[model samples]
Target: MADQDFDVVVVGSGAGALLGAIRAQEQGLKTLLVEKADLFGGTSALSGGGIWIPANYDQARAGVRDDLRTAFGYMLRCVRGMASEDRVLAYVETANTMAEYLRSIGVPYRCMPKYADYYPHIEGSMPGGRTMDPVDFNAARLGVDALETMRACPPGSKLFGRISINAFQAHSMLSREFKSRFQLIGMMLGYFLDYPWRRKTQRDRRLTGGQALIAGLLTAARKAGVQMWRNAPLRELVQDASGRVTGVVVEKDGRQLQIRARKGVLLGAGGFERNQAMREQYLTQPSRAEWTATPVGGNTGDAHRAGQAVGAQLHLMDWSWGAPTMDVPKEPAFRAIFVERSLPGCMVVNSRGERFLNESGPYPEFQQAMLADHARGNGSVPAWIVFDAGFRAQNPMGPLMPGSAVPDSKLRKSWLGKVYWKGETLDELAAQIGVDAAGLKDSARRMTEYARTGKDLDFDRGGNVFDRYYGDPRLKNPNLGPIEKGPFYAMQLWPGEIGTKGGLLTDRDARVLDTHGQVIPGLYCVGNNSASVMGPAYAGAGSTLGPAMTFAFRAVSDMLGRPLPLQHADWLEQPERAAQRPAERMAQAA
Candidate 1:
């Protein structure tokens, strides 16, 4: 009924949108954080929570070195002609600055000291990565009302209800170390204890990883007094006579509300990953909204459409941070095909029962190989992950976890089937999974040879350190384990994305630029809604997140006329000193 005006109006409630809102609020701007869905965090809540911030203080503090030239060399080698020099330079420069700023505002994170770069062979890459994610946050600190409204991590992604685990923990859960085993026992105890309570409460609140990342920000936002509204979809950009985006028109609670943004409207909403029409228009291949890893009704390009309506230029509109995924009836969403595909006893084969790319390659590179095969002849269009019973008993595949019996409800299918299959023999597995029986058997025979020799003459399955990260260290050739153990299995994989990385064209400061390369005042973009400064290359664990945060911080700084507040782990400086009482400290000094 009444026109609501604010200093800044942000669309989408992902990390980028929330970061902008938090910054705006901290800077004394009346900021509004809006999400189209009922949830607070969008795709960000579903992520692995790595932010690739090269040359960061966390790395330095951890005794891992990363410099400007090294980061520059990596970007130069990877990005190529995909993005502007200024944008890339700004990202590397401000990554550490942004990290410091967020810490000041109460966001916490630990450095991933051992996580290597995805493409470490490239120039200027650091084997020890610069990625970081939010440390664990307590949901009780955010209160029950806010916790209930936040999005929950998909069941397939979580190990124990809502109990989120980090990458190190994920890989080391069953480690041989006594401490690790003790921790594993503790984790299981916690899960069993909390699982019943979670069922009763109807909410998964033990946030970790990406969920923890957003939860930390939520805590910060609450402290900063930033107001948030869920289920508010942007309908149009409210532009002035001079073609300046002054505000936004959002449909909230079935009413059209015209909200004025005094400084600007930042479109950190998202890319077109969840919009089937846009995906079809931009992509040459067939992909649907259901195929995307983003939330069901979220990120349908409503914000991007509003920006486009106001003549905002879109760049690399069809790009995304893709991974191999398979959807099952048991899980509500497509589950990311993670470490399972690279285990010793596993092999990914096309329809002809032929091996394509290195099954143990980086997920994005694996995606390109799959797409290339599909584009050529649909060879990998419905590729199957062929593995043996030994593999099945040792590792998890997509929806199937280790040690859990394969669900028998819908297990059987014909030779031309799509989803999954299991058989007592390689030929039987091949026929049930729909691949050339001879081709599969012949490949299995050769794979057995390769497994013994620890050398794959064909695709080099376990060559790189990055590939080895997903494999078993116990094996001599971890990624080259034989598929001789029967009965074997086959599960199909589809190309899916963490999220799209292309949208509005923005400059170094994150100001949305037109086709003529002129900045449009009072308009900015970040996250996937803006063309990624890192371009098509996913360099490390948190490359997408790291730059998303950096660019969003830069955009906020422009809006507020000041750099973000610099905060550090102040308590870590002298923990015992902080614990001591103020009067007691004076007495002790005396």
Candidate 2:
């Protein structure tokens, strides 16, 4: 017997879970969203909040040219058959519609015209305008209590870990554009002027990045009257004799409760990145929980374990949304180095002091390069970003910030020996960081020469539009500048990820599939809980969240028995391996 009932029970409180709950509730279903931790918003709240939707309504309104066919072609090339063609097609075709739906529901997604695709050289890749970010939202709208309890954005995502700035502002400021100075001033003034909220919390009420995205979704969920439960850790799936998922057992208030779900259960609880044991069993070697930048409390594979117990097949468990993270002293979590690596006058090198990859490339590829080099016994697991005083003056390095804004004099004395290593000469820097001195000197000289010649002879650092997107525009090659200035520095970088990618495999409609590739009726998975739609490859900036929210929308639509979109209906209807109906499969087994 069930203790309580609802049309849907949503596990996890990230962007996808909240959006799914909202959609289900708005469609007249009694939806309940549950989170294991007391704090709402999983890794999604800690993310950059960029949503990549090709040919989105916002882009069209802004007169940016794009189409489904072009996006499909580009993604197909990027993933190289690692992902399902149907799934890829579903995302490309339905993404624009999903974006339109979000806007209708009050998610203010504004297109970022300069945010180029990670692989712009690929056929059908657009120069920019495929990615959109949620505009800054006032936290006061969600009320003081909600704002106080929400998971805060990471320090790397904010200005000095306090002030909020939009994605566009971050780009301009990081690139050190002339207009960015005034923009910063205006932002500081706006934040300080909010005197009433300032007294209550140091956190900026003007939310940006993942904070804003989750705030918007959380607001929608509340408005739709979705029942939200905190500290309710899902224990197991409840199924009837026929094997149809009907409810879930969750620990609430230190007691297990069986809640009946009339429609289905959504497992949106995030990946296993934070679980050290899971990391050892499934992921590539040399990975660690300490390396990940996800929130500290949860996302330890609760959904994956529960789904696997019921015969749900898992795929791509070894892959992740990899990024190089910097270890800041005394910080609870690592800070991912995203914008800093692309700036001029710096290079990432292995212990042998050899340049291994194009430092200015996309973050995932950057970490992949590290792991690949480490696999070859080059000791690239803890690589170092070698930079001179010139680079320090122009850019921020992890938590160090810019030298001009925060000089070495302002840095903590404790940080000098641990957070970073400083040297008056290249050889001295190499010695302090335990790298080959000769190799360091040679690499620095080569980079200096490349900056003067406007050509990266080795890795072609600024070869593409994507690489140059975050680079310094004042230089001949935005990604190349002389590293000859005295007083060099080195900071450690680990192959860290925002979240792991592997989990329960699902179909185009976001229905969980069993071992035999049949749908497990009344079960759906979204976000990091399911196998990523993009497969092993990352498409663009918002690749993770875009598919997450899109499929969440699709899951609710399928739950309501809504018809598939007409344009892609033909391909979608033709499943390569025909999935049997759940009841039919159960009867066959009997």
What does each candidate score in C-alpha RMSD? Answer: 10.4, 3.8
How far in Å is the alpha carbon of 60 misplaced in model 1? 3.3
Candidate 2 residue-wise lDDT, 93-173, digit = tens: 888788888787777898887888989778988888999998888888888788766888766667877899888998898
Model 2 spans > 4 angstroms off: 569-590
Whole-model Cα lDDT of every candidate shown, in order: 0.77, 0.87
Ten contiguous residues with the weakest lDDT in model 1: 564-573
Error of 1 at 228 (Å): 0.9
Q: Which residue pairs in candidate 1 have backbone atoms (N, alpha carbon, C) closer than 3 angstroms, thus clashing?
A: 50-542, 52-542, 104-567
